[model samples]
Target: MTDTLKIALAQLNPTMGDIAGNLALLRKARAEAAARGADLVIASEMVITGYPTEDLVLKPMFLEAAESALQALALDTADGGPGMIVGGPWRQDPTARPPLYGKVYNTAYVLDGGKVTTHRTKHDLPNYGVFDEKRVFGAGPLPGPVNFRDVRLGVMVCEDMWKPDVSECLEESGAEILIVINGSPYELDKTEERIQLAVQRVNETSLPVIYVNQVGGQDELVFDGASFILNEDNGLACQLPAFEEALEVTEWYRGPAGWTCNPAHREAPAGGMEPIYGALMLGLRDYVNKNRFPGVIIGLSGGIDSALTAAVAVDALGPQRVHTVMMPSPYTSQESLDDAAEAAQLMGIGIDSVSIEPAMQAFNTMLQPILNGAAAETNAGDTTEENIQARSRGLTLMAISNKLGYMVLSTGNKSEVSVGYATLYGDMVGGFNVLKDLYKMMVFDLARWRNQVLPKGALGPAGRAIPERIITKPPSAELKPDQKDEDSLPPYAVLDDILKCLIEGEESVDAIVARGHDRELVNRVWRMLELAEYKRRQACPGVKITRRAFGKDRRYPITNAFRGPA
Candidate 1:
């Protein structure tokens, strides 16, 4: 048995379903670790097939490809370099059943000496809030420690470390160190929660821990690496940066007491709006580039939502790639026009103006006769007219998107989405909505934060990317004359609080009212939230920032009749 050891935590980003590409990433990390004099390298969960995998693991061919790539990497260990602990799907029995082949597991393999020495599967499969592992993977049995180079190492997958049972079992089984591989995604203040959980495990097991996590955007989910190490005495030994790929080698020595890591790099994970903005930028960047879009074309309305969307787009893709168009109608104010142009100028992006008044007139003329027969007279203030303006802009934006092959980026916030304040095909027309999960209040907060502080890795220019006027001005859709959002919905402060209670807190009307809101208003907000389910169902995917984001995170029935107590 060796008295000294060196371990490397490889925090990396992998593309989903790109088995060969992911294998290359692992190989590179291993080589770097080996160069740094690491005995073993630990990567995050499912690094071989990217994270989540979703139903892609259901296909036998995909599993076969993943296994082949994993074996190829295992062969690389023949060079007597650092061994690897890599995550992927493992097929237990390939010829057992006709439908599923056999039980499939989320497994971690230990590759050394040109072969896989041992493997462990995930014990707990998460089923809540953006996780559907229970449907795709089989639960692993309670596991013991894996002996690597005469040292007992207790290994746990992503969700396995959430509770204490796995750690307890490992401690009782004589595991000296706890090593966890994770694909944990980012939510608000999630970094602290992870650190606390690790501390809990350390306190319970009385053994040091090495947490390795992946970093990248996978559809709606954005994984923040922020991998860390905790000493046996519950002291933080090392911390990696959040939202970035890193490889750090840690030295360990076994004395009379047990294994203890020498002091290494420690960086406080980003706090407050920094991580939120990073998640947005990274999420948007990956979605567009990974899907192979030329760029993005946004309908810049000069409102807070649209302005923020444009800034994020430019920061994510750079000004050269992001295209902005001002789709102005008769209701579009000159102030809005100026604001949009100034904001675009600050970001060094090109903006073009297209008048939608002609299309609006054509649509009104086409529908005037039918509306007159049904409602006595067609009123300009009617929702039909308002909808036509929105549709006209949507059509114009879609036309531009088709010709230029750039995806449309929508800017509607969650408050607007929850209350059905968004037009279906109008402002809601986009391949991706960056602010879909953020409330209107959060939209304002992020915009103000961006103007004050430029995020790291932002491709846009420094200084205020969004004009101060845009941040301070009253928000409007500019669909009708002198219209404010409050004319149709409650003030954002009240609306966001109530919506958060209903959506994230899952509180009833009575419970929300207890928090100083009017019971009737709470009931009305709840009713609107329920009624807008169909619209959200059709909305494009966005970055998930909240614990209970829309889409896969929250599932509500469209045709339900159940009502909460008022």
Candidate 2:
């Protein structure tokens, strides 16, 4: 039995469905770890086929491809380099008949001595909110510890470590060290929760736990690679940085007491708005780059939503790849125009000024005679005209996007989206929405936070990507003369609080009223939130930052009639 061990945690980013590319990345990480004198390398869950493959795991050809890649990786250990523990989908019974053809488990393979020595499957399959693993993958049996080079290594998948059963089984079966490979996605303040859970397991087993998580964007989910290690004493031994790919080699030695880790690199956990901003930046970057978009185009309306979107785009794709345009109507103020121009210059991106007055006038003239006929007189209102202006700008952005091959980035936030305040095809038209899950108040808070400090690995300017005036000014859509968002909706501070209760809290109308909101206003906000489900259903995908993001986290019926307590 060995008394000393060297294992490397490989925190990496894997693109979904790119088997060859992911294998190359893993090979590179293994080489780097081998050079550091690591005896074994542990990668995040599903590094070969990417995490949450969804229905792709159901495909026979895809599974075969993944198995092939895993075999090829197993062969790489023949050079007497570091062995690897990699996660992938494995057919539980490959020789089973037709009905069991696609039955696969989320399995981790232990590769050494030119072959896969043994494998462990995940016992728990997550089913709620952004996870539907139960539908795609079968639950694995509770596993015993994996014997690696005479050391008893307790191996668990992502959710397996969340509870005590798997760890208990491993410990009872003679596990000396606990190693968990994960594809855990990022949510606000979730890092602390993960650490707390690890501590709980450590307290239970008195065994050091090493957690490895992937980093990158997959659809709306963004994984932060805050992989870490906790000693038997429940103290942090190592921590990889969040939102960045890194590899750390940890040395473990068995003492008279038990296994102990030599304290290694521990990056200070990201706090405050740092992780939030990193999530947004990395989410946008991976989405654009992975989907092969040349760049992003934003409709910079001199509003907080659009301004923040532009800043994020600049930081994500660099100034050369980001483009902005100002589509002004007759009611567009000179201050707004100047602000848009200044913000564009500050971010060092090109801005084009395009007036939508022509489209507005044409639509009005075309509809005037029909309305003058008296049949449509009752239906005509200022809202129709305002929406026309919004649609005209949307059309302008789409036209530019078509010509330049750049994706149009929508700028509406959760507050506007939740209340049906945003025009559907107008402000909501985009291939992606960076602020889709963020509220208006969060938009303001992030804008202020971003200006004060340059985020790590930011491609934008050092300070003040947004002008101070833009933040302090009252938010307006500029669709009508002297228009402000408050004209139709409640104050953002109050509205966002109510929304948090309704969307994230899922509190009933009366429960929300108990939180010091007007009863009638609470009911009204709930009504608006329910009515806007259709729009949200059709909205583009954005980063998932909150515990209850709109898309996969909160799934409400669009055509429902369930009015809670009056």
Candidate 3:
């Protein structure tokens, strides 16, 4: 038995489809590990193609490129440096396969002495909560441990570590310590949940576990990368930072009591809007930067949502790259205009005004025959006019996007979008939305949070990016005279709580009302949410910060008529 085993966890940021870049990162990490004399270096899940490759893994070229890169990495390790357990896509023969098989797995290759020794596939392909692994990866059988430098190191790629059976099987197969590689995305309290999960496995197996995760944003998903080591007793030995890239070697001792990692740095896990804010920053940054958008343009309404969206965009793309446009209508109050300008000054981004009244007037003139037809006779204060104004703003933003080469940033928060409060192709029009998963209440909280702290890794300067008045004022669409959001929907606190119950908990209205809400209100909220699924279906893709975001996470049928409570 080995007296000591040193393992280096490579908590890295890998760009999607950047095989050469990912390999270079792996080689550098390997070099760092070798310098530290680590026995084996471990990287996160799919470090070659980046995690959650989504539909890209379906392309044979992408799979082949990743495999080739993995081979290149293996050849480089021939220099007799530290052995590595690097994660990547591994293509299997598809002659005998099911429909869901990419035949390529979310796999990890254990390379030692210039050859790929053990290529382990991922078990437990998670289908829910921002993951569609089962669609892309064929399920791996229960993995056994790989004997590396006299240590039986069991590998669990991402989803494998989430459940018990994988670890149980590994333990039964004589695995001493577990090394878990993850592309786990950031959600509220997921860091602590990971620790607890690792603890559960350790308790079940009586072996220390090393949990390593990828750090960065991949489209909507943000991997926090709070990798750590847990002792056999489930005590935290070493912990890497969350939402950032890092690498550290942890020493382990294998005595009669099994393996125990040496005590190392313990990062105090960040909670509340800070982590959520960081997720938004990273998700937005990666989407804009990786896709090579010159900049982003946001229609700043001077409301909490748009203000917060602008703040996050500036923080993500920096002030120079974030452009704010105030497309005011006839009903747009002077207060909103002033606040928007103030917000732009604070965020250090340029703000321009394009009055939509001209467009609205032109639309009204053009649509007068249709809008003033028999349909107008029945309705007073019709929303058709409101939507026209909104669509005009949308048109202007799209034009700016086309002419100026700026990707439009949608500013709708989850609360408004959840109930279809946003106009179709109007406020919902954008290339991306960083605030899509954040509820209305969360927008207020994060705006306040952004003002207080210069969020770590944020490029924008601090100091009240969101005007305080914007947060304190009642949120409104200002499509008509005195248009407050509460007129169309319930209070945000009640609304957000109910949404949490329905969207995340999948709770019935009866269950929701049982939690002290009025039954009628729950039913109404449930109705709005159900009715809005169609709108959500057409909404732009956005960063997913919550456990159950609208797009990929929640898949409610639009044609369904299932109502809850009353």
List candidate 3 stretches off by more than 4 Å.
94-102, 373-381, 564-566
For model 1, the superposed segments whose C-alpha errors exceed 4 Å read 96-98, 373-379
- Residue-level lDDT tens digits of model 1 in 201-238: 99998899999999999989999899999999978899
Worst 10-residue lDDT window for candidate 1 reads 372-381
RMSD of each: 1.6, 1.9, 2.3
- lDDT comparison, 1 vs 2, better candidate: 2
Model 2 Cα lDDT, one tens digit per residue, 1-566: 79999999999999999999999999999999999999999999999999879888887788889999999999999899999999999997665433432378998899998999999999999999999898878889999998899999999999999999999999999999999999999999889999999999999999999999999999899999999999989989999999999999999999987899899999999788889999999999999999999999999988888999999999888999998999888788999999999999889989998988778777877888876633232323578877888889889999999999999999999999999998989889999999988999889999999999899999998888998889999999987778899998999999999999988888887787888999888888888989999999999999999989989899989999999633
TM-score for all predictions? Answer: 0.98, 0.97, 0.95
- Estimate, for each residue in 226-318, the C-alpha lDDT of model 3 and write its tens digit: 999988987889988888889898888878888888987788888777888888888888888888999999998888888888888888778
lDDT of 1 at 475: 82
Comparing 2 and 3 by lDDT, which wins?
Answer: 2
Clashing pairs in 3: none
Identify the superior model by lDDT, candidate 1 or candidate 3: 1
Residue 171 lDDT in candidate 2: 91
Best by lDDT: 2
